[model samples]
Target: MTAKFIVIEGLEGAGKSTAIALCQQFLTSQQIEFINVREPGGTPLAESLRDIVKAEHQESVASETELLLMYAARSQLVHNIIRPALAKGKWVLGDRHDLSSQAYQGGGRGIDRTTLQTLSAMVLKGLQPDLTIYLDIDPVIGLARAKGRGTLDRIEQEAVSFFERTRARYLELAESDERIKTVNANQDIAAVHRDITQVLEYFFQGLN
Candidate 1:
């Protein structure tokens, strides 16, 4: 059987990493072969791209630059990690993917959708996630969670209003796409984990 690609997406501090971890645990217990990875940093070169993009500075990285950098890293990730894992019939779990660009660059940075689509098509080589789990949380709450951490990246340093737009866009994407599932992130940690697992299980069960 061919492996499935599952991408977990959300605004900053929406507990995407934790939920991804939980999802992986579920797959492991069920004896499902899987490969877990994240975008913009999966490959060594891509990880370098991540540092260049995330480093705090006031050099004014344009929205297009952000989009391109993400695609550049994504291009490398697909070739080095995603394609091989899928070819081996290992389900691939992605922490974040193209939708983040749609939300962050298109929504937060006010970039045009047409350009994003064009760039994505060019770099992604038509690869798309089979299932995208969008963890939805209010921007205010998400920002607060992000701030609780020790440091902030260039993108994270954006104003709260930027994140507000980003979160709204993420929800918009979820509503418009059948493959995208929205999971409320405002609940207690365990509850959030359970809800995410239920959604994943439902999807995986459908595959079988």
Candidate 2:
């Protein structure tokens, strides 16, 4: 099988972690060689950027600054981790990717979509996930789940309206993209996994 990149994207508390774990198990069962990674992470420099982005800063972080930092981190992860793993014929499973920036910065922060697209094209250089599993959920419920888990991070602490916009962008993009598969994460855990399993099976069938 050709090496493929799979990404899971969604708002906070959308069960991305659990979905990723499920993918890992599925890949393991199929004896597929794969590496799991998270956006703004999976590399030393990228991890640092993740910290800065998530940290509560005394000085307000400018939207442009945050956008640049996200690209920088993505550049590192793509160059140092994702591409290399794919080159070695290993599948790459990601917790998030370019779409997150489009939704969070472009939609939530109300940045220009063209700017975000230009940055993504430059940094990614045509690289894109073979499959993107988008866990869809209401912002209100998702935010509540996140709050119940623990203290929210800088991005997670954004207003509910911000997430509402983010979710809207996510759905809009997913609907237009053939590579993206939208799953109803509002369903019970087992039901969600069953749907994910169905998606993966269909994707695998297409691969063959």
Candidate 3:
């Protein structure tokens, strides 16, 4: 059987990590084989790239630079981690993927879509998630959760307007993509987990 690629995506502090982890746990209980990977930080090279991109010190980084580095990390991660895991017939769960680049760079930074499309082609090599779960949340609540996490990264330091643009772009993409599913993430953690699980169950019903 071909491996199922699932991508969990959302703004920072939207409980994406928690939801992904819960999904993994549920899959394990079902005796499913799976590999969890996070984009821009999966393999060794990609993890290094993640540090550079998320560090608070690089506040002056240009939009183009950020986009390029993200693709670089993605290129490495795909070749090193995701492809092999999938080839082995193990499910792949990604914490975040290309949609994040589209949101953060194209929407937040207002980059040219043509350039992003070209970069994605060169780096992603046609690999796409079978199912993309978007954890939707308000920017204010999301930023509040981020603030509670203590320190903020360069991207996290952006104004509310940036996040608004990011969230809007994410919704736009979700609405256009049949494989994408949006889940409300403003509720408590358990409720968010329940919604995610319900979505996943319905999605996987066909596979089962």
Predicted model with the maximum TM-score: 2
* Residue lDDT tens for model 2, 1-208: 8899999999999999999999999999889999999987889999999999999999999999999999999999999999999999999999999999999999899999889989999999999999999999999999999999999999999999999999999999999999999999999999999999999999999988
Kindly list the per-residue Cα lDDT of model 3 for residues 69-119, writing each as its tens digit: 999999999888888999989999899999999998999999989999999
User: What lDDT would each prediction earn against the true structure?
Assistant: 0.89, 0.95, 0.90
| Model 3 residue 171 distance off true place after TM-score fit, in angstroms | 0.3
Encode model 1's per-residue lDDT on 45-142: one tens digit a residue.
99999998898756877777888889899999998999899988999999999999899888999999899999888877889999999999988888
Tally clashes: model 2.
Answer: 0
Local distance difference test, candidate 2: 0.95
lDDT ranking from best to worst?
A: 2, 3, 1
Task: List candidate 1 segments past 4 Å from native.
Answer: none
**lDDT: which candidate is best?**
2
* Alpha-carbon TM-score of each model against the true structure: 0.96, 0.99, 0.96
Task: Give RMSD (Å) of candidate 1 vs. truth.
Answer: 1.1
